[model samples]
Target: MTNVLVCIKRVPETSGQILLSQDGQSIDARHVGYTLSAHDECAVEQAIQIARSTDGEATVLTVGNDDSLEQIRNALAVGCTAAVLVEADTENFGPADVAAAIADAVRSRETDATTYDLILVGNDAADTGDFQVGVRLAYALGRPVLTGIGTVEVQDGTVVARGKGPEGTEVFELSLPAVIAVQEGGVEPRYPSIPGRMKAKRTPVDMVTASVSPVGNGRAALRLPPSQPSVVEVLGEGPAAATAVVDLLYKLGVAT
Candidate 1:
């Protein structure tokens, strides 16, 4: 049977409101309450789908503190059979560090002859919109990786996946044991049933202290919110009235 591994992260709630630090470099997670990103939830669900259809074991892993354990338990509640945590003290770690930590855990499992046929992750963590960990992890593991997958399925000995970029959709058929990064809307994640939740609470999460490298290359500072538009100025009242609006848009380089 194939063993599938899914990677997930607990991130802030979905919002366009970017809380900046005093410096202009990164976000402020000070007041943020981490939750499972919607996109990643889909990734987890997709892994479950693959496992159910292919008759394999699906496991979810995350890197962070005990809060990450909470997130992994939720994934288990949905469908995953087990959870792994590379416990970190804080969320300040970068993708390189997270990747390294995860690589360590993966290598350890492999050393024990624990088998895994595939590994999966989200295209990007929603909170930071940083699409790096999955790719980096794949590179570290020296495995082929596919990113931005929209649809996925396993047929025979190969896994088929579809992805869309600026150009269009691209289909890929990958051999087993590949890494895949999935996007949202691919599959609706299921909520945990009461029995699943109970079982998840009982399942022991394999926790390992992460040897994550420190991050602070350049300190970031926060800034205040930009001024909001005070009032609306009516422009085009009708199609005939849009001539001037179109002219203004042309001047602003939005229209030719």
Candidate 2:
């Protein structure tokens, strides 16, 4: 059976205005909600699909503190058969640090005879936009890796990945035991059902302590872009605006 491991990160939901912390080292998430990135959710869905089709197991993993349990349970509710948490304070953990922690966890699992045929991760982090984790993780494990993949499938002993290239869709094939960084839009992530949620609540998460030292991303501060200015011009009010509308459409070359 093909055992798949999907790596995810807990990121602040950006549905509202994002505030930075006083130290400017991270986002101010005290008042905001948290969720997985779109790419990570898609990767989890893909892993579940692959595992289900192969009669295998899909395990979800994350490097974060206890608060990340919610996100892990969400993945379990969808279809991941197992879950792992690398207990660590991710606030100051850069891409290299995160990658090292995950690699350690994977090696620990291997020691116990639990080997993953494929490891999936998001193409880039939603909060930091760090696109180096998957590549770094692959390097640490001595495995081939592909990034920006939208679709992936396993056949025989090969994994096929497809993504958008400069010209058109590009496809690559790698042997088993590889890493793939997934992008969104390849598959629709399924929502958790009531029963699934209940079942997930009972599933115990396996925890591992991160052994690597945190070398924070060399960022002095975080800055938000200036808001764009908006200007509105009222055209007309009621039926009296018919003439103005026709003229505007004609000037835009949409009228015959």
Candidate 3:
């Protein structure tokens, strides 16, 4: 059985206009809603799919504040066996701190006899596009790592991963106890059912304190480029525009 650990992040959903903080240091989430990162949702789904086939169990882990419990419960509602929360001030932590915290959590789990055969994480967090967690965790654990993975499965004790390459699909094979950074567009994440949600609500999350001090890479501020407005063109009018319409269609390859 392949026991898997999937890491997720609680991020502000970009369903509406994005608002930045006055200093451009972060997203202005005062009016926005929070949810699991899209890529991490796919990672959770893939972990469940793999574990279900082998009668194994999948655990979801997150490093955030108390509010992150909602995201952890959401993963449990889908199919994860349990959840772990590394309680911390998520806003104050940078990518390096997050990675250190996760690494510490993994080590703690190992001491408790909860060994994971595979580790899965989103290619990058949704809120901040810091893509270093998986790689850093792999290094901390002294395991092989792969990123931008679109598909993953186990066969004969080997983990096979696939993703889009410059020419076509690229594949990689690794032994058990490996790390993978899962990308979006890998699979459709299943929604939580009524019964599943009920069960998840009852599940107790294991909350732990960080064993390491959070360190930053000296980040200054974030800036976004101004958006370009759309332009509309009027192509003549009425019957007089018939010739223009035909020409437009021809130019668009709708007709020869």
Q: How many residue pairs clash in each candidate?
A: 6, 0, 0
Which pairs in model 2 have colliding backbones?
none
The prediction achieving the highest TM-score against the true structure is: 2
- The TM-score values for the models, in the order shown, are 0.81, 0.91, 0.88
In terms of TM-score, how similar is model 1 to the real structure?
0.81
Better of 1 and 3 by TM-score: 3
Q: Find the 10 residues in a row with the least total lDDT in model 2.
A: 226-235
Per-residue alpha-carbon lDDT of model 2 for 1-256, expressed as tens digits? 7899999999999998899888777788778889999999999999999999898999999999899999999999999999999998877788999999999999999899899999999999898898999999999999999999999999887999999999999999999999999999898999999999998999999999969987888888898788777776678999998999999999999998
Candidate 1 C-alpha lDDT tens digits along 1-256:
6678999988866454557656565566667656787778888999898888888888899987876777988999988998888787553576777778888889888889876778889889876667888888889898889988978888776889998867777889988778888998767789899999999898888987766676632334446677787897777677887888888899899986
What is the RMSD, in Å, between candidate 3 and the native fold over all Cα? 3.0
Residue runs of model 1 more than 4 Å from their true location after superposition: 15-32, 165-168, 215-219, 233-256
Global lDDT scores for all candidate models: 0.81, 0.94, 0.90
Q: TM-score rank, highest first?
A: 2, 3, 1
